[model samples]
Target: MTRSIYSFFICIIFLTAYSCKDNPKHTDDIAESPEQQLKQRYSKLVTYPLDSTAFPRSVNLKTNNLKKVPSKDWTSGFFAGNLWQIYELTGDTAYKNKAKKWTAFIEKEKFNDRTHDMGFKVFNSFGKGLKIEDDQEYKDNILMSAKTLITRYNDTVGSIRSWDFNKKRWKFPVIIDNMMNLELLFEATKISGDSIFHNIAVKHANTTLKNHFRPNNSTWHVLDYDPENGDIRMRVTHQGINDDSSWARGQAWGIYGFTMAYRYTKDQRYLDQAKATAAFFLDHPHLPEDGIPYWDFDAPNIPDEPRDVSAGAIVASALTELYAYTDNEYYLNYSKKVIHTIKSSDYILDKDIEYPFILDHSSGDWSKRSEMDEPIVYGDYYFLETLLRLKDLK
Candidate 1:
């Protein structure tokens, strides 16, 4: 009886393999294209009444609920930016109407000076809107947001203040992520022909280049400066595994920031910095073969840590632009690899998934145990941006 059962199981396995090989109508044949997947996801998202000042920040893992953020939140602009990108990508009127409506919710942030995230808030939404259709209102809001951002710049420290809440521990903290905010300043210069904006951006980049990096080109997440004498007080990490460990998203921000700087200034130093930083990220031993990175490179549990899809998406977008500048096949090919990896079943959400977001399984504030293993708004934004960049490359 045992021998008969073994023979029957063997025949079944062989037939299954043969059927799979012979059938051209497998799931791949019916799977939606990436563009189709995006449209379906956004169609679901637009069904929600997100017209208030509330924006989707990330999903709550325990409750499986989408977290709504206030308009003043640092992540306020990404959802609208995602909408704008979708409109540009598919030329869908539904997306354009939603983009305009959501972008209007963020216009008040142009006068919000409490945080140094104007670039993230204004540029991601209004800046993209202006780029798409050249709305005078969008352009005006962007310029106003740039003015609010420069208010955080300290001429003495030669860097923008990253946080005001941690005042006791950090006198004048400058996070590496601040480098991304400089895009607002650069754009302001072009819009107004004001060299002050350009000068501040250059000085900030120079100061960061001098202090924010180690000998190996890995960056610290934060650098605290003494406002009194323009002296470095401390270099630390707020979101990384430790004071010395590299945060995956921080590295991505560094890569994208320097690439953007190079685009604005045509500065060889920024380009070199971008390339070296990208190498540090890609050549790291801890990076997964699938192109997604752990929450932190130095996280204690290697291979078991949560992957930050936001970091992967940001890196893919930045690498595509870097490819345009350098014409390097490595950047282009690696970015394509990342894009494919993100589109795999592990990262991309199914149309029926309860989460109304596109990408899944991003690590947000892992140390705080917040938003762990969920979809973040910025992840969706960067994923769309990466797809658009890839389309342009094609």
Candidate 2:
């Protein structure tokens, strides 16, 4: 009887120990440390090169058959931007050389035309590249692009003209996405001592604040106007169901862009807009338990619309920015929660190290979209950025 009682007690102890080992309080046993977690999430992203050989050198407008296409002029610039980030993280000169090569390519294809995405596809790339490399040629190319963008600015409207293809119809077609590119304009102002770029950026930001952003903090993807008259004609969403609906990626852009504006200008209004948009984004009832948002907040009556982990990652990164800007403990805590959610959720394919893609549930195209629920290059970029941001926080 004594032996039986002792054996039973030992069995119970063994079972309890096994359970504790198997079911740890933490999510992943391997991700024991923050560095380890970051490595697990972002290490694969480091392998992919941003050169033309690896990825397309330019946007394939002909192949895609879109009414509006991004110019090839911006592709190398885009790669340059990616390479700058790579250099920052890895301190690899190879990345810097590639960035230089990309800048040269962009310079060779320089277009004098002013477009809305000059900041996104060009300035963010070459301007950031110049900042990273400090090459005279790259600087010259960036200056040219900035001049083109500034030339697009209309003194009458007090904003830059976005798209010119619809020449007679839409005039100052600004977008929330352009907010991210304002850095280029500001940098140009500092470098060239030209207040024109600065003034244009401020005016565009002010216009977006007054017109594009909704009362709920969600933003329209596109804001069209009559450049000749400086009159607001229509407010539309480029990526969402309609003008009234919310697109997840657009929301993320607004969050990141407004925060960036605040950082640059220290404007209280920009900060308020950032907080409002972020609050509305976080308060969405459809946000999954993991805090990852759906592709479109109002994606219509579908049984299972795809969730965009990429958008979530973008928002997480922006949230970190917000946390830094406000130094609010609540924002920091929430940012940590978002990071934790992304790490544990299946959206991030941590197990598949062999695969190039890091996060799943990416929607490349929603209109005639090919990769509706497949992996996307930008998704990988944003996820890696999020991990890097976390590492910086640590």
Candidate 3:
């Protein structure tokens, strides 16, 4: 009886192996395409339960739970934009309906002027909605959002203030990320035919170009200005590994932001700045073979440091745009490589995951011990953007 039982177990194992070997239709035998994986993921995400009090933010890796952020959070608009992009890419009304619902929660933020994240909060949501259909309401809300964002712009500094907190440490802080908010201003001018918005956008981009970049073209993560005389008080960082180190995401932000500014202004300087920053990032010695970067380019630990998939996603999207202007195969190939790696199982979330985040292993701010190696909403947003851009290029 003991010999029979052992033989039975061995036979079952052999049969399973044989069956899988011959079965071409087996799920494990065929890899899902990136497009298929994302569309299916979006199909389920449209029905994912919401807290009714907040929008989906990131997963709490410690608890393996979805984290819902309030509307005031800087990342509040990203979820809605994700839904809108899903609709754009798939032409699925189910996603549009969910996008509309989620976007409504962010409309009120158009008037919330306390933070410089107005574009992140308002433009990402409402601006994405406008791209699908020219709704008067979305346009108006976006214009309002642009107007509110400019309130944070100090003419003395010729840049938008990034944070309202940590006043003691920074008199007027303008982060490299603020380069992204200029989009809302540029869009506002197009919709309203107002030169004010365009002028401000140009000024902000020019100011950032002058002061944010180091002699090597790597941008300082933050610049604090005197605020009175428009002179820079200090160049520092809040989220980078150190004051002088190149924060991966901040550099990615500079790439995306400057590339975008060039699109609007036809300013060769903006294009040059974008290309220089892209070179700094793509040529960095510490960048991984897979195209994803460590949390900081200058981190002490070379291969052992945490990866920021968000930075990779951001660069993939930005480089695709840069390729359009320059016809540079290097940029296109690198961007495609990033998308390839990001689409792999190492970055894409597992099929059985409870949350709606697409990619994982994005480090938000390593120094703060916040959202490290977790799924951030912005990572998914930029990943979707890369998908859209790549589709267009094809």
Measured against the true structure, the TM-scores of the candidates, in listed sequence, are 0.91, 0.77, 0.90
In model 2, where do residues sit more than 4 Å from their true spots? Answer: 1-79, 92-94, 109-114, 166-171, 349-357
Q: Per-residue lDDT tens digits of candidate 2, residues 5-81?
A: 22232223234222222233334343334333433434444454434434432122224421222235333244456
Tens digits of per-residue lDDT for model 3, 152-235: 889988988889888878899999999888899999999999989899989999999999999889999989998899998899
Best by lDDT: 3
lDDT, each prediction: 0.82, 0.64, 0.83
Model 1, 145-171: lDDT tens digits are 888888888999998888898788989
Specify the poorest-scoring 10-residue window by lDDT in model 3. Answer: 1-10
Judged by whole-model lDDT over C-alpha atoms, candidate 3 comes out at 0.83
Q: Where is model 1 poorest over a 10-residue stretch in terms of lDDT?
A: 1-10
Candidate 2's TM-score reads 0.77
Decreasing TM-score order of the candidates: 1, 3, 2
- lDDT-wise, the better of 2 and 3 is 3
What is the Cα-based TM-score of model 3? 0.90
